[model samples]
Target: MSDRRSEESSGDEPSSSSISDEVWEQFLQDTERDIRKSAPKEPSARAREVTERLKGRKGEPEGWRTGPAWQEMNGRAARRRRAWAVIGVPLAIAVAVVAMRPSLIPGDPFGSTAGTDTATTPLPAETATPTAAPSAAAPGTPTLARPFAGSPALRWADGAAGIVLPKATALGAIPKDRVELALQQTRKLLVDANLNPDVVAGGRPRAALSVLDPKQPDVLDNLETSLRSPSKTHDPLFLFSRFDPKDVKQAGKVVKVRGRITFAKGKFGGVAVHADYTFVYPVVRAGGSTEVTRTIVRRVIDAELPDPTRYQVTPGRLTLLRYDEDAGNSACDIHDGYLHPQFPSQAPTGSAAPSGPSIDPYDRSRDIGKQEACGTVSRT
Candidate 1:
């Protein structure tokens, strides 16, 4: 038993010594590895060479740089900033507005007046001149006594005085005095047909008819027939400015007129007077409404005085050559001897439907060309 115990003790001591040695060696190795990993490394060869070169180089003098001055650079930078502020601000705002609401932008910034680079096409004589716009200044509301208020006719001359006669000049064989006589007679006839209160009130145009030469074809007969029995074919309203007494009455005494009387050589070796006039009459409801309305009557007439020495013409009488008429704010198709003015509140009656394009009555820049159908006026 003593020999066995000795052998075991010897084996245990060597085993313990071997384990302690192994553990110590392992710990030393791990510490060495950690130290190597944590320690800073040496500079590369290229880095050391660059450092040496930089350290040995001589520095530039105070103003060696070749470029714009610092102040100029600063100015450029400031200008850039200002440019950004000017353009970027509005751009940012526009973007924000578009994002919020897209419809505020106009579909067409320019209107119909904007023209293209294409050549301009020729327009008709009547359409060549643009229609004159009404007064931009606000006018007073029309009253019973001052019906011409708010109307273009407010600036027109009153009665026959507005019918300005041109300077009498001899035409062909007609003398100046004879031309003057014809003009005076023609002026009287126009006054009788239009300005005369009796004729305008639907009474017989006796003075007007008496001045017309009875020998002329369809002159006196047609006028008489139209006055007696008016129809779409024969309307006396062509030459005469008559209105229905029962429906309306003159609102004021003033009858505004504007026109030019020009004379030229006649067809039958006489003097021809071409009169183009527009008359404005203020009328109110005869049934006692104080509201006022204006009737615009435009007459374009050609009357001639024949040379009694050569032709078998009546003395001191005028011959009707050609005539054209247009009435605004009046009924469309009614052919009675009186004008049927449409009031502001009144809709046209069954017989008053317009068949032609609407026209502006205040536009005196164009001629009343041949219109086959009744037309509507843009305004009263």
Candidate 2:
């Protein structure tokens, strides 16, 4: 589950009940800035999600054009914040469907040359084919919405904004079916527990840690560093610091999260299954001054199911093998989510802190991240 899964859409139609192109493209640019600014030298995890999603589909979208550079990028960021404040997923989009197209990048979605005329003024030869109408959804490829039952308890958490859980459907014992079930369940765990924003928001992470059968100590350690450090300007973004520590005692609440998960497995590993994930969550900035939300995050994560013989269903558990916070669109970001696909090769954007192995998204300004929100204390 790379950001592409969350960034790009499979079909040409605007599954989101035809959300206008302007609104969607603006969001693309705004989120990209969030990624770029998080770690200037490295690509933003969210940008990678946009890039990877468009990698397959290819090119600018039909009738969509980039706006002027003068317009502030955060203008779209503001609109996005408002959009997330509304619902878990749009009426037409499901857990896995995040739309992606070349026209998404402000002036150049694919980093290609820009066209001068409006949609009706078409005459450009070089970009014609690539920007043609979207291809039809391949025939017979069934698309269904996986149901999710949100954790009722989360509703009571103060400062809690909203959450996007994995899409799930009932499954049977068939080997083929088990793999899909495992993948869906794995995603649920990844978004809710493993990528639990509550940890950074100053809430307990037991919900996430509880699901790891063969726990990875790095998970908790990294989270502690991300939560503890204290830098005011470049406040910690959960997307960048999987568990990267920061300095703080007060912070913001997780307002919204955008997540995607894909299942995978095969012969070499004795029929095991695993999942890849991309998450984008927004935080209402810390501090008591003015209650404004500024951080918008996009992250990558990988989870593997334990040996089949020991697998359980009621509460699916998996080994926390890899959690690469802000792991941009590297070829290595995606884990096998489909049958027999090879795992992508992933490397750290930069060296991890030796004294503290997981601190990430180093900000040159030394403005790394924020502390947990009001009314919560460190569990470390």
Candidate 3:
């Protein structure tokens, strides 16, 4: 029994060994299939895992599953991994370079840094300095220095200083010869009482002669009539008289007369003279009260005769021929008081004579019937 048992056991042992080998072969084939399936097509951690698992299975049939094919697969995977590493390293470096490139641009990175360089820089040395302009003065104020201060003959009066008058020698130079000649000729005419001789015989008179004041109203009347009349009744030299006989006969005589003279060019190309005279008379009131009275006597003397129609002697053309003792007298009385004597019975007769405003003295005289009634009450 023992021997029979031994032989049977031995036979069963070969079969068992054969089965174990077949099982081992089957496991290796299954492992190789799993490795092929799990191996990464590209390099990855999964492919490394499969390679390591395949290398651990070294006891399997060498030619069938663990030889050149496996090696070639691992080699290809390593090469693919190396290539990806090279490409990935370069790509990361390229991305970093592109990101940092904008910082290297020309302008300042921070906005505050702009214009700072230009602001800190110094200006060029050749630049010119700016000059200041002069300031203007207020209106109506005089300048600091007078422009014509060097001139000796000019005199400034009224509101302005430095006013120039060629006639005044202090302000300006004047021809003494011409002034003397004019004065001499005027004196001769007054003293001689001759209208026949021309005042300025050869050249035109440079200055005009104006009669400032006459002694009597008759003097002015005669002068006006002689100047206006076609036939010369009295000598023209009589016009130069400073006193009138009628004035001496009527009232106490006065010595000097004061008046104004304005000169203009005459129609005959000579100096035209405008003369105004005021006559002063002494009057005695009640109780021996003596008073001096002034009346205007105006006359216009032109070198050339004027046409009656073209250049009529209106009341406006005549001015006060004498000084007004009372500064408050009406301008019309000062201008037209001389016309009183010419129209003696004008008011009582009610004649429509051209007359001006009457003075209070004349009006009282007319009412009291003392003097000749001269003018009517003013309508205006």
Candidate 4:
């Protein structure tokens, strides 16, 4: 029994001493960490947050070590946290730096513009310029992004409607005077709207929304809405529609149609056109019970529509103005969606179902706000 007691005591004494030594070693390392941190050096924002989070001393006195093993584990956990804090703080800064200075990156990081490439396909020098035919750009006019597709310019007007493509084939086919061109372009846009095309340029199936840019389509839709209510004043649209139910309704049949373009005073190239559209409505009677009937119709409709120069045009970007606004290089200048919402005006109400399938061949992408006009957007 004595031998066994001696052995038991011997084992217990060393085990307790060994545990105490390990505890002391951990405490010493913790003290060294505290000492290293004692000096007042500037801490990074993240490091400062970490320091406040883990506030306490290491290498505490012997009495402080008398708690559960979990207490020791917590101390180790805190030291690990401090190590990560030092590494993570710098990593966060690097990412922010990259975002702000995209120019520092080697290539196009955000997006690109359109029509700068052969994609739009410029006209060849060998092709003879027709009288007053549309071309890339006129002498005084700003350089256009693209050129006309081909000649005589109106397959629809001459071929379909039996109306000749206006021989305005003079001065880039764009009149020299801003007001004249504005009225002329407005007349053409209305004519195009009546035809209900995807997008029109010089009676040629050329540019998409860019030819009209952004505002012209809005003018057309708004006019259609106004003319639907004949009681409302729209002398200009009626004149432009040529008084045909098909033309004025812009949806039915007609006996006759004709019109002329007028102007509203404005600054620079920002002039508005008041089109005087005139037409006759053809009424047809159906049924053996009803007697034959004929009707004569003449109504005048008016609305202001924009010319290309009315909106600010950069190399690849087209800026839009609101109903009561002038186009400028301000934050208020928007460019997106047909009749896009301006700052004060929220998005115009629209039903998920369209009244009719839009003539635009392709849907405009929701991705807008591109700095360049249109280009191949991608990473280098």
Candidate 5:
């Protein structure tokens, strides 16, 4: 029995040993397969060796599985990656465009275009043609276009020469008939306060006629009031007679007369032409050495009168005389019949002859007496 038992045990041992060997071989094969699959093939030899040494050990925890939950999680991760990629790509493109866009801009708003050299350009010249010149005046002929025809002031007539005397010949020298006629007219004008034909023939006959009748006390009072009034006494006749006729005729006939006219210093002074006709009258001796003066007396006569433009006349025969004696080289002669207020009257008086400074008709110098200085105002 012992022998039979040993044989059976030996056989069983052999069978058991074979089975253990088979199982060991399968384990080795499976471990080799798992190591080959898990190891990285593209790794360097050293890295592969390291990976191989760690292979077939329990792998790191992998929760992903082939199930609905794994698929959904994979899908969400894909969408997130895709969204990040989309956002990052657009941001990069935008950054690049913004960085380079200014360099690509054209045309400066304030400055000139590039590649030009000059800073400024010149303006073109005018192409219009010139006009023709005006013609010149003839030589030696006086041009009436001058500011003053002949006198300094704008005169009614060209000059004083244009003035005519009452009943005097046009340009002929004053004769006895003309003087007598003027005297007679003067007397008639004084008597009737009417302008005679001779006076009218002169430029301002109405001025001489405007004189108040000496017999009419009301007229005299009015005249006196007008003379005294502060306002301008605008009697045309009175102004006409007061204006120096000689000044108007200065450019024409130059006549010297020994006569007197009333005068005032300031503006409204009634001046009349007065003359001693007795100076020219023939004296007759009566009753043996008892000299009785038989002289045809007359008021001052309006001789060769001046142009109306030269004198300032008012309706009441108020004459504004022009006596610029200073301008006439201090000559006191009555060139325009301007009577100096300071000069004594030529009429015979009871007192001895008054002696005073001669009045300059044209004395416009600043040094003339206060009365003459005030009278020599320019109408112009």
Candidate 6:
């Protein structure tokens, strides 16, 4: 009786080996159509998560720009998930059928075929957007206790300590010893020009000037002339970072500094040391107001030490090859001997009309370009 029942069951249903490829494909299509008609039309859970994320993004502070890569990825992922919910049915059914009845499809069961891999490819890895640390105050609003609160300089090294020097290496004809001396002198010159409290407070940068060769024709004379009488073409503040003492007073002893110093073979002779740095100074009204404002100065100077054997040069002094600067929060086109930092309460001058694009003083990714007229700043 058991043998008879087995024979009847075998006759009632066709064996897996007997099904043809065309029949198997038709079966998958039929099953997919039935499943599609039954599947819910509502968005999947992942779709709701994406929508919530977008809604939350709208609440972020104004002017806080984040990279678009992460958002773009989220959008792509949401779209892919929605697509798979519909099209994945047929693919999944096809795979299961091939597993249960491998001979029905012929050849390798999982062989590469057109449109077969539409669901298997993985999504690209995502990256999180970088964010600045929290601050006590928003940008453009400065307080004495949190002078650097909203500025990038808040994270920068304080004072001359930020002027880090690299290991001195021999360059061309110059030995390591001379290269080291050049590095040290260059750092001292930078400190004197920008970080010295006396120099910053409208006083002459005697120490900085002493670093240069006095015998160099026009170099010392030009600097002296600029200090004596400043004009648009000749401003002492171009080399020395100074502000009018009568207008503002230092809020604290800290001066935020960040940049790099590099040395290479001199274009003219010995070793050339290039210093590119930005200094952030917090100052208040000379009358001693508690409200604080910051002035940002970026200076790029190229100084060289000539080979003593080849030419006449000053000992322990550098030859000024190039000097360039850009001052932020300072009134434009005002060529006094000082950097005129504009206060929040001060009225805008005629030169305050920006003639060019807005610049972010904290952005050191590129060199500051030439300014023919007044330019606007994106931030303090």
Among all candidates shown, the one with the greatest lDDT: 6
List lDDT for all candidates, in order.
0.58, 0.28, 0.22, 0.23, 0.22, 0.59
Least well predicted 10-residue stretch by lDDT in candidate 4: 43-52
**CA displacement after TM-score superposition, residue 366 of candidate 2 (Å):** 26
User: Per-residue CA lDDT of candidate 1, range 222-331, in tens?
Assistant: 67787899865557776788988999999978898876788888755578888877788888889889978777777777787876655556778887665667666665
- The reply for model 5, stretches above 4 Å from the true place, is 1-160, 166-213, 232-380
Model 1 spans > 4 angstroms off: 1-137
* Highest TM-score against the true fold, candidate: 1
RMSD of each: 45.3, 21.8, 65.7, 37.7, 65.3, 26.7
Error of 6 at 350 (Å): 5.4
C-alpha-based local distance difference test score of model 1 = 0.58
lDDT per residue (tens digit) for residues 1-380 in model 3: 00000000111222434336577467556645543342111100000101111111244322232121122222211110000000122222222222333233234432455334222232222112212211111111111122111111011111111111123111122234333332333332222321111221111111212322122223344445434441213222123212222221112322112222333433321223332222222212223323222222212222221111322222112212211121101111111111112111111111223132222221111111111212322100
Write down the TM-score of every candidate: 0.64, 0.33, 0.23, 0.23, 0.16, 0.63
lDDT of 4 by residue, 1-380 (tens): 00000000111232434336577467556644543342111100000000001012344422232311112211111110000001122222222233333343444533455224332332222122122212211111001111111111111122113222232322332344644454445445444433333311112222212324432223334334433442212211222222222211211232222333344433222343333221222112222212111111111223222223323222221212211111100111111111111111112122211111111100011111111111110000
In candidate 6, position 26 carries an lDDT of 91
Better of 3 and 4 by TM-score: 4
Pick the winner on TM-score between candidates 3 and 6.
Answer: 6
Superposed Cα deviation of residue 50, candidate 6 (Å): 57
Name the weakest run of 10 consecutive residues (lDDT summed) in model 6.
1-10
